[model samples]
Target: MATTKLTLSVDPEVIAKARRISKLRKTSVSAMFSRYIATLEESKQRETPLPPMTKRALALAAGTAPVPENWDYRDELKDILDERYGLK
Candidate 1:
């Protein structure tokens, strides 16, 4: 696959943080942005919708929420309830 040069206009602070994180992760800022975009693409392809609370919780989140293929509603509900009620 061929890679292309893409330009983005982000806040300087965000770019600085990305650079710091990329260095720590031993990857380039371009790679980090590419992975982030790829993740957004993948989540966009999922059919499942994000639960209401999760949606609310991630109201500030960018792009679509990802739901795994093996995502279990009942188990997730149980876990959320258990954590909420301290019944775990």
Candidate 2:
């Protein structure tokens, strides 16, 4: 396929990172950005929509548990409900 040179105004830090990644992957920065653009286009053309807000909400709620491994989740949930309802 015929390719064109597209000029972009990007931060020097971003250019450094891209150069580093290109070196690690054994490819040119242009090729790396080309693959990225192709992947982005493929995702944009997909039939399925992205996950909704509810899924994001559930993920945020389910982040690594803050409780101890031996803790009883049900007991804590019950206690929370009781406290919420003013039930001693």
Candidate 3:
């Protein structure tokens, strides 16, 4: 892949720390920043295609599992809140 050089302005203290870390790792600061950027890009690429709530709704619509006959979502939510707030 083609690479380009870029200039960055940073605090002297931060630059000094980065230089120390780079020396300890036996690599240049540029390589460290490159790896950091690659990691961020990889995380973005690996994101879920759908949000959890939407996925659950889709599964329910598709009848993946039967809803419980006595299920009360409001009561379930209140129970969850009570548990979370130590009210129960």
Which numbered prediction scores highest in lDDT against the true structure? 3
Q: Model 1, 1-88: lDDT tens per residue?
A: 7999988899999999999999999999989998999999998898698899899878766566788899999999999999999999
Clashing pairs in 2: none
Clashes of each: 0, 0, 0
lDDT of 3 at 11: 98
Question: What would the TM-scores of all predictions be?
Answer: 0.52, 0.54, 0.55
Quote model 2's TM-score: 0.54
| Candidate 3 displacement at residue 70 in angstroms | 33
Write model 2 residue lDDT over 1-88, tens digit each, in one string.
9999999999999999999999999999999999999999998888585578977877888977677788998999999999999996
Report RMSD (Å) for each prediction in the order shown: 13.6, 8.6, 10.4
Give candidate 1's whole-model lDDT.
0.91
Q: Give the winner by TM-score: 1 or 2.
A: 2
lDDT of 2 at 82: 97
Better of 2 and 3 by TM-score: 3
**Could you tell me the lDDT of residue 29 within candidate 3?**
95
